[model samples]
Target: MERLTDFVLRHKLAVVLAWVAVALAGTFAAAAVQDRLGARFGAPGQPAYEANQEIMRTYGGGLVPLVAVATEPVDFARLAPLGRVVTDPAFASDDGGTTYALLYPPQDGDLTEEITQILGPHVRVTGLEALEPEGGGGISLVAEILIGGVGALVVLAFVFGSPLAVVPLVIAAAAVLAAFLAVYGLTYLTDVSGVVQYIVALMGLGIAIDYSLLLVTRWREEGHDVRRAMATAGRAVALSAATVAIGLVATMVLPVPFLRAVGLGGVVIPLVSMAAVLTLLPILLATVGPRIDRGRPKPSRWAGWARRVIRFRWPALLVSTGLLVALSSAALGLNLGEPTSDSLARSGPAYETLAGMREAGLPTGALSPIPVLAPESALPVLRAVPGVETAVVAAPGLIEVIPDYEGTATVENVLASAPPGARVGGAVAQSIGFTASVYGAFPPMLVLVSLATYLMLAFAFRSLVLPLKAVLLNLLSLAAVIGALVLVWQEGHGSEPVWGIQALGAIDEFVPAMIFAFLYGLSMDYEVFILARMREEYDRTGSTDQAIVRGLGSTGRLVTSAALVLFLAFASLAAAPILQVKLFATALGLGILLDATLVRALLLPALVSVMGRWNWWLPSRLSRRATRRAPAPQAGPTSPAG
Candidate 1:
């Protein structure tokens, strides 16, 4: 590690140039990333996917479902110029004001232009991708990155007590740009989501800043000796990145490509971020740290608080445990579904026309109707299901069922009613299969993550019990996040007041699973940071209580600052117009704050205080090989006066 730091210091100019070159290369690749990205999330081999494929091949209109509204009477003649337009005259409004149609070859802008030329100025045309505030783009989220980056820099300044905090922020931005390039390159190897580009950019910024903060904090603490700081803190950063990356990379084992693509982004973000910190951060610290890091601030209040926690360890542990338990109870009410189209807001004319229709006494599912391919005989069975507003056979084997409500029950009943020759599909069914594939992969993901994280920590700490305890605490952290998600998004209790998003009565199905992967990796990262330091102190002193105090004193400010930066970074996602992004940002921001302050700083120390020497125990043979048995432990420090 010392040699590594020396190499970076000796070749500092080369390192900077290398990063700049990578960033520039990445910028070019980033431009083409969106075209390589796919928005589809449906699971292959599932009924929804199969049904959707069949519908697409036969109908040719399933790809570009839209609505066309006219202030005057409908004009079939005017719409003829648009290519491959399909709709029924009967579905138009009774007043001949509005009609539903599908514009084949779903190019939103071209279709909108063509429709506008034909339907006149009064026509309002909208489609699936048009309803969001921003439609498809990749790696160009400079605005979101800037917002999160500025907030992170402010927090860094406060943490370090210097304006030089911008150093780490610059490195983080470079790492994020580089990560975007890597994801773009990944597009050639396999399928990737355009959304992954934004995710990589934003998440890369946060993780990179976090890693740089650790190195800078350690460098300042070790009297600005960049070499020694790198030897210790840099090693920890690498291991932490591995654990973090492992949790995300585990998604590759899942059966779905969307998740795997997302997981790859997760892996790339941490590793790239870690590389920037290790390479760029050390180079800066060696050359510029002594000049910028003027002096050490006064010891933080965390030392005093750690004293109080150890003094009243039982009360602290019990109270924190109870609070976490209570918060976790909200998980019982958790239900999962993707965002409904209405919740994306009527940002375009198609949704505007549809919303107006429903308000004007159309069926509840007027905006979203199922396209089914069934024999004509199955019409009665489909109609008998709940919420069926109208069932029309457009062709010999085709039926479009418009339901009165948009609920899981509606899709389930319709699919269930499919006879021998029927196949049901639509946006709702696609979402169902996407949700199912995510959950289907979840159990394996849980076991995979638990075992992988456990093994990594076990090797890092050389203690069986500690790794298990860390995993359990990580789960507790996630439980609180999930429960809060349920309360805010599902129950709609505090959504509007906190964020501008309305409670659509369902959480995005993919959000929870992705959240679990990210939170697990991050919580484990923090856990390793704190516990690794404690283990170092315990090995040196042979007293658990003293080790807890010193370790918390060492890492308290750094961990909290990193968490705050991450929370704020994730919070920046709320600026997105998507409700799912808002939900994810809110839950993650709250979760990080809770974990850093409550779980790591306070609760962990108290629990370790109670456990005493056993917190550092390893199997006898392993202990003999790894660590020397300390002589009989001395008494710990007495409680200090406030």
Candidate 2:
């Protein structure tokens, strides 16, 4: 590590140039690729995939398609043009024969109208239909998902208060543009869907910026010079980022094609972005070395306060543990269910349209039906189960039913739905044994998967107690965020006149699980990163108190900075023209801030204070040889920012 830093210092200019060139090339390539990828994985214009044309036309409103009709009657003069809106090139036919249309979302304008005109009359116009483009519900979802993200940036700006802080954001923007362009160019090589590209863009940008923020901040804190900082921060962040990338890649283990695309796209972007941060960011810092320190305020009272808290061990521990347990219990009360489109929608063109339609008494829930599969007319037998409101055979071997909505799918299964929450996924799959079909289990399965993931993370961390603690802490954070979301979105916490978006029904089925998986992993990332540093400090100087104080002081700024950057990156997704995307982005962004500030900074620190020597008191047999080494002196020089 020392040697690598030395080399970087010696060759700062060369290193910087190389990184810049790569970023530029990558940027160009990514731009080209994004266009190609958009052509390949972009939203389907129709529901059919024509190998001959090498295109997949999208159909319906997507996922649960929204079928709405505004009271306005079709005008004979405008019918021809209106038909184009419904049959635009963006709307494709599906095997299900579902009628679909793509509106020119106002954000994407001219192109949408041009496409709508091209389709010409084979389409139908619906509620508050506009020939001018309008954003989609998915975009609104993106906005909601990003709420916490924007807040995080504000928090980050406050935390770092340094000009260098902006560097991460810069690196992030360049990395994202490069990634999108590269994905676009790849379209020429293979068929990529437009929607998939957007997903990739969201996942890639969010993760890349996060990785960059972590790398750059750590680099400055650890290395003496720009180049050295780059090398030091690079190695640590690379390993950490790789771990996250690996986890994301693991998503391919599931059978969903869209998710697979998301995973693949996610891995590529972050990896490349890390490379840029380690390389170009250092060079930029070197060139603007002194300037990087501009706007950096002298350390604040919070730093001193945090340091003091670490020193007074017992009080900190009690507070942290008590809070953790309390919040963990609240997390237990959290409702697990699918998120609805309304839950995702932001106050935008798409949301406004949806609101107007809902006010007209249209069922906004759409077709979020639960499918029950049984061989040879078993719907009658299954319907006997409690909470199974009105079951119908939607297709051969498929039974659709309305859930009681009062209990989780797992709860309903036990009382009347399927089985206990624990048995809902694999157990249901095993019990049905190819005889019955299902759909709504996706949300339930997601929760189970996340639970299993937490177990794996616990094993990876090598301490049952700590991992368990981390999971519970994460749950508390998630619960608080989700609960707030539910109240605001479902119960209409602050609606009426503030935002204008009414409370949608239940949450979307995919949201909780998605949030759980992503946020849990991220929270763990932070826990491991911060804890690892503190443990390193403790190993050097058997003084847990000093270690916590020093460790937290050093990494606190970096961690908080990284969290802020990640928040901004994800929050950007809210700009997307999709309700689900907006919601997902907002929720995730918020979760990160909560995890970094409340959980990592306050709660985790307090617990360590209480634990003291016990924090590092692994059984002698479980302790590794390295951990047994003589303690280093506590007077080593602190790492600097550039």
Assess every candidate by TM-score.
0.86, 0.62
lDDT of each: 0.75, 0.50
- All models, RMSD in angstroms: 4.6, 10.5
Candidate 2 lDDT by residue in tens digits, 387-504: 5544454334433443333223432353244422211111122222211111234445545545664555433333334555665666677676676556554555633233444555
- Candidate 1: tens digits of C-alpha lDDT, residues 1-642: 778777888898999999999989888876777788887666787787788788777765553355565556556445644444445665666666566554444333436666777777777665444553351122336777778888898888888777668888988878887887888888889888766766787778788888888788878878888888887788889888988887787677777777788888778888889889999888777777778876556587777888899999999999999889888999877767645556554445656765776655655464467878888788788888887877877566878787786567788888877777687888788778878787887888788889988887877787776788898888998998898888876766777566544555667677887788777788777888888888778767867777788888888888988898887777676666555667776787888888998899877888888877666556666655554563223222342211
Model 2 TM-score?
Answer: 0.62
lDDT measured at residue 429 in model 2 versus the true structure, 0 to 100: 22
Error of 2 at 267 (Å): 2.4
Report clash pairs, candidate 1.
Answer: 126-350
